[model samples]
Target: MNVMKRIAQSALKKTLIVAMATGAMFSTQAFAAEKVYRLKLAETWGANFPIFGDATKNMAKMANEMSNGRLEIRIDSANKHKAPLGVFDMVKSGQYDMGHSGSYYWKGKVPNTLYFTSMPFGMLPAEQYAWFYYGGGMDLMNQVYSPHNLLSFPGGNTEFQMGGWFQKEINSVDDLKGLKMRIPGFAGEIMAELGAKPTNIAPGELYTALERRTIDALEWVGPSLDLRMGFHKIAPYYYTGWHEPGSELQFLVNKQVWEKLPADLQEILRISMKTAAYDMYIQAVHESGKNWASIKTEYPNVKVKDFPPEVMDALRAANDKLLKEHASQDPLAKEIQASQAAYLKEVRAWTDISTKAYLDNEAK
Candidate 1:
């Protein structure tokens, strides 16, 4: 009986040893796999620059939380980086692991970047979002950026951007001629085609430039952001927008940095950016409504005007001519133009049937 008892005790001890060894192995593996990844991001906006800046902050927070502290992103705004237009180059060169800026800002470096932002007479915010996620826009955008060793994603949306706050009204197409306006990106190019002299001014100097008559007109953003800039005080004529109907800011990530992240972290980053973008769009809509109401009530002197049909026709023709020139110059540009045109036709039909029809009914 004593011998049998000793055998049972010895077998139990061996089983316990194996279980302990197996658990220790897993513990070691788990510890090694849990190493934190730290990345630095650079943004084109100044520190604390409203909706644009909030997007980066929101993205970083979501990524960190979702990754359970495995991912940490440090952001440097334009003030720290001192290169508002250099975000694309910085992320591509790996000076920054990521960047937050408008893709159109890099149009000078890569003309294809212009297509990812809002186009003149293009889709609205909802339609644009549908194109981005469903209508091959993401795939095309990747094709444009892959060569640069960078990945681009939508950072945020500014909704429908307002036309320039003009010191005087635009009653005719001829009024655009020789007008010096503070505009940028593809819209500025469009303006230049209409015989307007478009100048790029820093946001910090925009108010002073307009106030001092350094610029005849300027367009910042819609009521959502423009009220804070105080453009209404100086420019009484606030024209409706046609240039940037749904401007989307972008997030640029170094390809190498993205590849280095684990698949889970990569997904976390992607989802976080997408969420932040949609959130900004919703916020922009709410803010626009609230701010415009306040402006109408408090500032009775402000006049809102839409460009006359003749002016619109001229601008549209000019826009088409420039687009044709671009398509003639580059095959990729031609492809992008065709894709957006086709997608817009299909989507706008449904939009007209749904949103437009409903709104028209409500007007009655």
Candidate 2:
């Protein structure tokens, strides 16, 4: 009886140990499966900025749904969480997980960032997307951002942009002198070289500035945005086909946060960004077509003119000089330009045969 009791006690001890171990294993699995991550996204434009604003919302929604609610993003526009320029540093330091804005805004911090924005007479929207996604432009962009502990994705393009809105007719390059223009990126530099002073103003402040005559000329974006912002009421001389040929917007992610995402999540991000890029470009073109028609109807006094041949020639020459200077000073700029030019040469052939031909035929 004594031996039997002892055996029974030993059996009870072993069973208790087994039960505890099983419970711990189940708890560990539950904790791992319940893991969730939140990302804070910042954009330079306000919530009403149309293409960019809509794209940001769409991206966040897609990410959440595709992740099955495991990865969530909360987006804030300018002054919502941080200032526009502060976005780069905030994401770099992991204060925020992502940023959506123009690369031109950060040219002071990373001069090569301008390449990601737009080059004067550069690739058009479709070509730009091709170069970035398939022609190694994205890899070069990531290389430029790698030093700052960030990763960049080409989010969208603004297609071919208008020259700008001016208070007076720019019949010659001389008319540009002393003109206070609100342009950014390489376009601003080119403007400075042409004897104009380029000023940086946020979109919300643009209408008031133009109305008050604080600035003589302004280049916000294409017709859709310009019409929406009421630039037609302020500036009578609307010019086309100079400065920004194609404006590209970017999605910047913190390096650490990007590295932490699961492989499946990363794939989701890449696919979603590609989709947003194509969708936003299509939307811009569609809206601009409607807006141009409306602008002609509503603003009869607004003189829509193309830049003179001499002015366009001068601007293009100046742009080439600026590109050379940038490349000489910054190795990364040199690499990016080389990559862009090479890819563009390949893509332009097909574009010339297709889009260029179609437009030329339509013009006649």
Candidate 3:
């Protein structure tokens, strides 16, 4: 009987060992099944483009570190993709899993997109950020992007854009007549309304265009980005901005690809993008101050001017007319415009009191 009991005990031990080994194998398989997801991102900037490219790189790095190898993102700049303006279409069709480009660039393809970027005389950066996060801008953005099978997020801010680098000063509204400028989006429409010939040129070709008088003026970001373009050397007049008060770049994600990410990884990506966007804004501010100081010190010949009161009035009138035309055509456009107008009114008051007031007081 004792011998029988020993044999039974041995059989039980072997059964338990088999069960434990099988469980371990299944656990390993489960872990393996959650393999690293690789995604491709296309950007609208050339390779090694300064602040814009850095934003994407930083986002990818953060995502990778947070996911602990579960997610990987590869970025292809305009140099690699050779489709700077086609980022929207490529991401929509899933040819690229993500994209970094200006949302306003899609105005021709998606009219509502214009509202999400900076409008002519729009809210400043802080106010716009508040509107985006707290004032229903994100929901409106999602509504606009959802039909395209893409998700949109604020990629970064260019702070307050410098008006443009001009060969001649804009002294009056008459000076805008027949002026050839390379500007894009709604601002270009506003320029055209004011009788300026607005053209769109690739960033890589902007300097050559300006130098050769192919375009008389161009607005590229601010000192943060424009300094590197060497525009200060060719275009002697630097105008203060009235358009694109706070330009925001966008991140485009293929909805299908975004959906495929695990819950944890999705959170990681969202946080990564948000953090990177904020970081880019801060970096841009730092670079702008540094580069503007350099430009003033090194290129003292560059004249800084603001649009005259008459020119400002004409531009504002044109902007109002065009916005009205847009609103009249599409209900969604009207809704967005109304939202922006309301938000801007509410926020600009505080900005005037808080920011403008301080500056005015300090200057005095």
Candidate 4:
């Protein structure tokens, strides 16, 4: 399939492209009347990181093309910004007009921010997206970020992430004890409960950290982006995912900067971001299937394992306890958690009956 042709044929692309052509009819006069707006974005990933970085590029390209040169978005990766995890703070302080990062990165600063990203045993992308757009998840998210001078939107989805590449097989919960891993967000907290040492490592440094024994095991997404990182050489055991069912990335806009945009430009930017987010999810599915196939054919030493039932139960219990503790301390956290649980229960019923049932039947 021709990617450009497919995009141009999309409903969104057709609308915006027609609008651009229509505006051209009034070009002579409108050219002088239209003011160009330029914005700078800071992303958490280093330069040219796959999937994550591609989302930013796609968003920028769509915005520029849709707005007909009125809106220009320039991205600065971690190397340029020199602070991968500081995207939220920089965007909030107006140092950058926008940012591409994960919302869960800010949980330490704003406890409620954690819920915006994927949750352990939470709703998948489509369901969580339903919660965001239709089920008031977006409103709740703004309630968390608005006070901080930011507007957060879904940047992209990495789909379901693999558990992690481990140095040893996890036959039981005891196997996790004293294990040093480079996992992050609330998932790291849960690991800490199980006597494992969990730390956050920047993407550029993940390979070196794991190789040099700075961290024993790490989960840096699944095969879509992971195969390129060469983790299989260091850790032979690949575990299936239980945490971060659908890892959603985030795009942050400075509230003041957003309000300054013309209504048409704002709508264009919003649609561009939304389109890119879903595109990333689809792209991940394709990349993962291709890369995992390569791994099976080319890498015989790599081992795949799911956490044993006993270990899974322990993680679930810890997740519940931590969530309760967080909810009790913050009313907003409680509301968000309740909203997710309710939405998950509502959506997962259909998911099981439809998608799950289809897949299981096809397998048989």
Taking all chains together, the TM-score of candidate 3 against the true structure is: 0.92
In model 1, what lDDT does residue 1 have?
22
| Tens-digit lDDT string for candidate 1 (140-195) | 99999999999999889999999979998899988999999998887899889898
Give the per-residue lDDT digits (tens) of candidate 2, residues 1-364: 2456547656755665586777734344433333567888888888767987877887877877776665688888886864876788888898889988888888988888888878888888878877787888888888889999999987777767998899999889999999999999998999899999999988778999989989999998888678888888888888886667778888889988988887878887767777786777788898899989988797778898998899989888998998899889878788888888888888899999999899999999
Shift of residue 227 alpha carbon in model 1, Å: 0.3
- TM-score of every model? 0.91, 0.90, 0.92, 0.91
Q: Can you tell me which runs of candidate 3 are displaced by over 4 Å?
A: 1-29, 32-34
Better of 2 and 3 by lDDT: 3
In order, how many clashes per candidate?
0, 0, 0, 0
Question: How accurate locally, in lDDT, is each candidate?
Answer: 0.90, 0.82, 0.90, 0.91
- The 10 consecutive residues of candidate 2 with the worst lDDT sum are 25-34
TM-score of model 1 vs. true structure: 0.91
Model 4 TM-score on a 0 to 1 scale: 0.91
Give the per-residue lDDT digits (tens) of candidate 3, residues 90-163. Answer: 99999999999999898889989988879898888888989999999999999999999999999999888999
The candidate scoring highest on lDDT is 4
Clashes of 3: 0
- Between prediction 1 and prediction 2, which has the larger TM-score? 1
Q: In model 2, state the lDDT of residue 115.
A: 85
Tens-place lDDT digits, model 4, residues 138-191: 999999999999999998999889999998888888889999999888999999
